[model samples]
Every structure is written in structure tokens, then in C-alpha cells.
Target: MTPISSKGRTRGGLAALICGALAAGGLAAAGTTALTPQAAHASSHREAPLISGTPQYDNTDLYAFVSPDRPDTTTIVADWIPFEEPAGGPNFYPFAEDAQYDLHIDNNGDAHGELLFRYTFKTHVRNKHTFLYNTGPVDSLDDPDLNVTQTYDIELIRLKNQHVMSKTKIADDVPVAPSNVGKASMPDYGKLRDQAVHQLPNGAVTFAGQADDPFFLDLRVFDLLYGGNLSEVGNDTLKGYNVNSIALQVPTHLLTESAHQPVVGIWSTTQRRTAHGSYAQVSRLGNPLVNEVVNPQKDKDTFNASSPWQDARFLKNVTNPELPRLIESIYKIKAPAEPRNDLVDVFLKGVPGLNQPPHVTPAEELRLNTSVKPSMHPKRLGVLDGDTAGFPNGRRLTDDVVDAALQVVEGELVGSKNDLGDAVDANDKEFGHTFPYLAEPTEGSRGPLAKGTSGGTDVRSQLGDALQPAGESRNTTLIAASAASGAAGVLLIGTGLAWWRRRVRRPY
Candidate 1:
């Protein structure tokens, strides 16, 4: 045989070492390998480069679970990045028909076998009218038939053994729905709304349509830190004030593999038409939005490519395994030595933190352990009270994920007795009490404005000032200011009490 190249020999040796370690450490018997420090840091978010601009395909978040609000059923919430403009009207956002959206679950730690739930949409244009309708001067309006009818059907596919074996239509021949507040007849928007609020056979309810985008992140602040390098540190600017959203609610029985203890993972996918008329698609195939990870500048066009599917294949290659190391290297900070392998156990294993894990996953996919009983009318601020249904489970539109994330970063969730040290809450934004649960916009309403006018003034400056951190003093002027800011304080107080007490005590 020809002599093996030095590089090939090295690779072979490394593979043997890995296998030997797994077997010797007894991990092979457990069907799991302890993620090496490097491998633990390799976990990435947002794979497709083009997804940066296309929030519809961004797959910003994946949530799987037995619903806390409705324990008998399971709910899968997939949040896409780059929030859409709610008023990006004319063509409201809808899931791509050809695209395959999936929710995956790896019950074993090997991260190989996954129970996949896929979704596909088929558009149905009821009326071939170009324009939706004309509002002000019907006579003067260029397009009188501005109101058009559109509908789409939704299909769910279950993937096993790398092939789709079963398919179910969540919505059978449903109309393209519109916002609920609009007139019912002119567009008969109610029909669409009604179609969305249908009841499934298992007494489980499913709603899929355009709802108020619930994700609220201070994108402007992030941009300021990395892009503009602004000095306004205590500012809170919600750049994604409005966006298109797709919401779904399913019974828990449907998700669980045998009503025993339900556990699952979820993620979304998007596809687009290639220049060749054929389509290109992306799946769990690659790391999402590499621009956010590697090269922010050169990755823009890469993120905008029409063929995201092609990009998925090379995802694992581009991913830097020592991502946390890279960050620490760049920042010139020491990497924390608090057991990185245990992170999956703490973060993804439903360990209480500033927020609960969205779901339980064998390897960090959005995991929801159905064995955990659902909380009836559970408090939304989960980690504060030790409820596992909140943030880490499936993040709700109203979840204070920023605050939750901050707490985790500060080591607040792991307990004061732990060597990692205790952390305190920094940001404060509670959620509303409904589906698509985001705090109601500070702006009053959405309607026709004066000739030369604008809608809601930026509430960030005001709200940010009122909510800024007060340093070591637990009761600072900022807290008082927030307390005085209308009913916000009451909600905060209630949620805070629940969080403080629940966090202090462990609940099974």
C-alpha cells in the first residue's frame, strides 16, 4: 500500500483517540459523548447567510414543549430573526410553500437520530385582483381593486429515517388571513381570522396567520455596540417595533411519542426560487447566518443568496469550533472554567436560570420535556419562579428574554451557593397575557394619520431612561421611575415577587 500522508495519519489518529476516550469514559455505553470544551463552543445559531435580511427564514429561535397554558397539548414555537415590518403590507409575510419548516428532537445525546416535524405552505389566491383595495379617494385612486382574496394550505410532515413517512394538513384549504382588526366584509378579513382559530381533532387548537410580530429586541442598541459604536450605553431602542409573525398551538399528545414523558426539539426552514426556475432550500443543513459569526461585512451578499440550500452543506466546515474561545481571545478575557460540558445539563436540561430552558433537548435543540406537567395559567416569567415553561422552553412574544439572558450571563440562575457567584436582574420588561404575547406597543393605535404626520414616537429614549440600571443599590431612582411609569410597575412587582420566591425554592 502507498505510504499514508502525514495529514491523513494525523486525522486517523485523532479519530481513534476520540473513539477511545468515549469508550473508556463509559460515554459510549450511555450513548453520549461529553462535548469537548471545543465542541461545546461549536454550537452555533442561524446557518444560512441569506437569512440575515430575510427574517422570515432567519429561524432566530426554536421552541418545543408541552404547553404550560394547555398542558394536554404540545406547542412548538419557532422564531425567525430580522423581524419583519408589520406594515410591509401589499404582500404580507407568509411561509414559503416550497420551503420545509421542521421541529427536531434527539432523545439520545448522540445528536444523530431526530424526530422531525416539517411544515409546508401552498398559496391560494382567491381573487386575482392586483390591488387589495382603495381607501381614501376611490375615484382618484389608481387601483380601485386594492382588496384581493388570498388563501394558503398548511401541511405537516413527520420525518424519520431521513425520509418523510407521514403527512398531515394543519389547515385544509385555508384562506390567506389578514390582521383581525380590519373590516370583515370589504376584505372579509374575518373569514381568514376565523379559519386560523380552528379546533383540531384532538381538542387541540391551531392558529396560523399574520399576527402582530411578538419578538422585541433592542436591535438599535446592538447595532450601536458593534456597528456605530455609540456612547449611549443606557439607551433602549426597539428597532423591530413591528414584524410579520406565524403562530401555532398544538395539543401535547400530538407531539409526544406515547403520552409517556414528552420531549421534542424544533427549528424552521425556508426555500426560494433559483434563477433556473428550480428551487433552492436550506434545512438543519448548516449553521445559520455565518455573517453574525465570522465575517459580518463579506457575509451580507452571502446571506442574501437566493439559494440558501447550497449554503447549508458547508455549514459545519465554516463553523469555528472554539467560538467561545475566539470571543474570549478577541476580548482578552479569561475563559470561565466552570465545567462547559455541564452547560448542556444546566442550560438545556431545564435547570432554572434567569429564564427556563425553552425546551429539553438531547443536544441543545429547543427542548420541552413533556414529562414535566404543564402549569395551568402558568406565570410567564418562568425561571424567576422555577417554572420550566418560559424562555428556554419556547420563548413567547412577551418573554423578557433579554433580562433572562442577562441573568444567565451574570450567573444569577445557578444559585448563590454555587462557585459561579450570584447575579442580579438588570433589565426589566414584562409580557402581556395573551398569545403572540408581547407587551402592547406604547403607541396608541394604527390608522390613517394627518397629511404630514407620523405614528408612534420612539418610546425607547423615555423607556430606556426610566429602566436604566441603578448600580449596586437594589432600590434606585430608576426603579422608582419605572414604578411611576403607569401599570408597568404593578406587573413588574407581581412578576418579580413570583420570580424571587420561585427562584429561591426548587419546584419539581
Candidate 2:
């Protein structure tokens, strides 16, 4: 994306430049936390030391947007359990039974959630006598063969200034989409996903299940900030990985203060059950990279636990960001002057006349103005590309947030205009067009290249090559082959988790 040139307007003072910059297209950048060895990995994926160890309770990315197909509704997607290897099984990933996943809406710009959607999951195991996850080929969510399953309950809670005024169970016993085990087991995975989607009594649609990790970016920046020469770029780090996702689509009027006030702030949090049986908020995500790149080590965990209204302590991170300064030191590009109030406004509050609500509380949130209709031809760079319908208006599945945020972090807003990007522009997989828009989770059958079948081999052929020995009878070898595959998958999981922990522990 090219920079917005100064053709009609003169480069006046910083204030004028800020106003002009915000008016044309708002800044999508926000203050970031300490860069870990896993820096630039999927936004908010394993961002903190404590949360990194608890993937199921970790908040990966949050997306909120006016539904492109049905403009009358807004879709909010929050992902957890980052980097889920499709093959990691026996006991595949499941929503933490003891945790409470919540989606919060600040409709009045008060930085406090006026409404919250709390999701609690329960696991079901029909055949404890067998080691199999499924007894036979599964065709539907309620298929008898599916021995292990999960169901969740959704509670709609109304609060005034954080104190709950009302709580109602909107959905109960909603089936969660099971993991896409290989084709033989879950022959029609798509059908299972469709069955998992549930319609709530409040005219809302909800889905909870495994989906492809939609966040894409060049995560190799951890290697001395792109090999310290921009050499390590363009690779989508999150490709092939899956995440457990919770998607909700609610009527537009329900999220806003009123028809007149369409702007609303959105965020998600994961609360784990403590030893005392009290649920404690362990993970929170709003904007894509706020906790990943803005907060320091000392404050990363604190940021996760704190509420939006109590964000005053982290204000310095926004006003005087470290990312630009690091870029300046490494690349010799001059950093923007200190005290970046423009960042504070756009990221914490929202862009005025765009998505910013009147009487904003200046807290970090994915603020969306439902009044702005969906774009027919969405620009990946989002608002920076003059497509106000995308982020930072509210993040869309297709928004190139890494590029837009990079450009802004390099001082695009304060007149140092240029394009800076991670080069990885879009998600490796195409997102769905329906209610739960995330792409289907990668199936467990995927395997690495073998000696002869290396080029463009289809998955079925690969599976056959992996399972059937030369001239071996199908029935005789299938059981042994499947056992071997399961063992390999378990080994893969162990190695992957160890590698990830090492990376997470590395100092920035």
C-alpha cells in the first residue's frame, strides 16, 4: 500500500498532521509489550510467560466486524489454544472445562462492559472403556461413534459499571465441533461443523470449535528482528496450525448504546478456575498486538488481569512506545517524538468521526461503529488503505493488520509516511463466508513429503503411502499403521511444546 501524499493539504504542525492523518485513515497501531523470542508470532499468541504455558486459557486474537453478508449483525470471534498441531490427539484439544470464556462489550465508551457473553464448557465421554476418541466413523455432532465430545452453555449478563444487574442463560447444551481427525474417522468434517453451530433464543448465532489459526504474519522477526537485515520475511508462521474458536454473531442494535450511538468497544477474556473455585481472569485480548508488543515484562501479566477501566497505569506504554524507538535504533530511521498522544487516541479511544464513541474512556478495545456498513471490496490494509469498513474501525478476517500497524509504528500518522510491512499479507487459508467465518481446522492426516511423492501430492495419496506398506493387505496393516500414527502424533506434540517453551523463555 502506498502512503497518502500531501497533495491537497500542507504539512502543518503535528496536531494538524495528526488530524489529517486520522481523517484520511486512522492508525491501527498500538503500544506493544516486550518482544519475546516468539515475537511477531500470531498476534497475542503466547504473549506472556505465565499465559504461554497455558495455551487453552491463552487468548490468541480477537476480531469484531459488521457482518459482511448480513449487515444487520456483527460478528465477534475470539480464539484460544494457539498453534494446535492437527495431529495432536488421543485426547485432542478441548475448551477448558473449568474456565469461563467471556466476550465483553462496552457500548457507552465507559471502558466497563455493559454486556457480557460468558461461555462455559463441559466434556462428555461416552465410552471410558475404550482408548479410541471415536468408536467408528463419525458423521454428525451427535453421532454415537463420537465417544468424546463437549457441550457449552452461554450466559448473557447485563452489568452497570461492572456489577451484574442480570444474568440469563441464552444457550444450553450446544455441541462443540469436534477436531478434524483424519478423513477415515470424520469423513465429512464440514457436516460436523455445520451441526455444531447453534441458534440462540436472542436471535444470535454461536459456534465453538476448532478452526484454522486465522492470524498471519512473518514471525521470524524473533531472529534478531528479521535477521537484522529484513531477510527473514514473507513466511506465514501460523500456517497449518489450528485454534479452538468461539464465534458469535449478534444483532447490531444489541451491541450499541442505541441506533444513534453505533460505536461499541469489544474485547475477550479467559478466566480459569482457581483453587478456591473462583474464576480468575487469566487472559485478555482486544487489539491484535497490544499485549504482544506494547506492555513490558513486568506489566504483561498485570495487563491480562486488569479491566479496561483500570488501564490508566499502562498509559505511558502508549504515549511513549518502545517499538518505534527499537526500529529507529536498528534501522537508523528517526523515531517519532515522544508522548504520542495520537496513538493513545486511535488505539485506546478510537478515531474521531470514524469509530470513536463520544465520551470515550481511553482504554484499549476493538471499537466498531456498526453504522459503517461493510465494504464490498475490502482493502487488506484496512483503514490505512481508505477502507474505513475494516480495521482499526474493527478488525476483519481479511485485514492486513501487520502491514498497517507496521506502517503506523514507523510514524505514518505523524507525517513520516511510508509503507513498512512483514510481507506476509493474507491468511494462508481462505476463510469461510458464513456465520462462523474461520477456515476449517487442518485435518490430522497431513504428513511430510516422502521420497518419491514430493511434488503436489494430494492428501489421500499421502495417507495411503503412509499407511499401506508395499504389497500389504489393507485389513492386516490398518490397525498397526493407525497405532504408529498415533504414537508419532504424541511425540510431535511433546517436541513442539518443548520447543515453544524454550522460545517463550528467551529474553527479548
Model-by-model lDDT, in order?
0.40, 0.81
Tens-place lDDT per residue, model 2, 15-119, is 343566456543424222211111111257899888999999998999999998889999999999999999898998999999999999999987889999999
Best by TM-score: 2
Which pairs clash in the backbone of model 2? Answer: 31-294, 32-293, 32-294, 32-295, 33-293, 33-294, 33-295
User: Model 2's lDDT to the true fold?
Assistant: 0.81
TM-scores, all models, native as reference: 0.57, 0.84
Error of 2 at 198 (Å): 1.0
Model 1 off-target regions past 4 Å?
1-48, 53-56, 105-117, 124-130, 133-146, 179-195, 224-240, 272-280, 283-335, 346-362, 374-381, 410-508
Judged by lDDT, which candidate is best? 2
What is the alpha-carbon lDDT of model 1 when measured against the actual structure?
A: 0.40
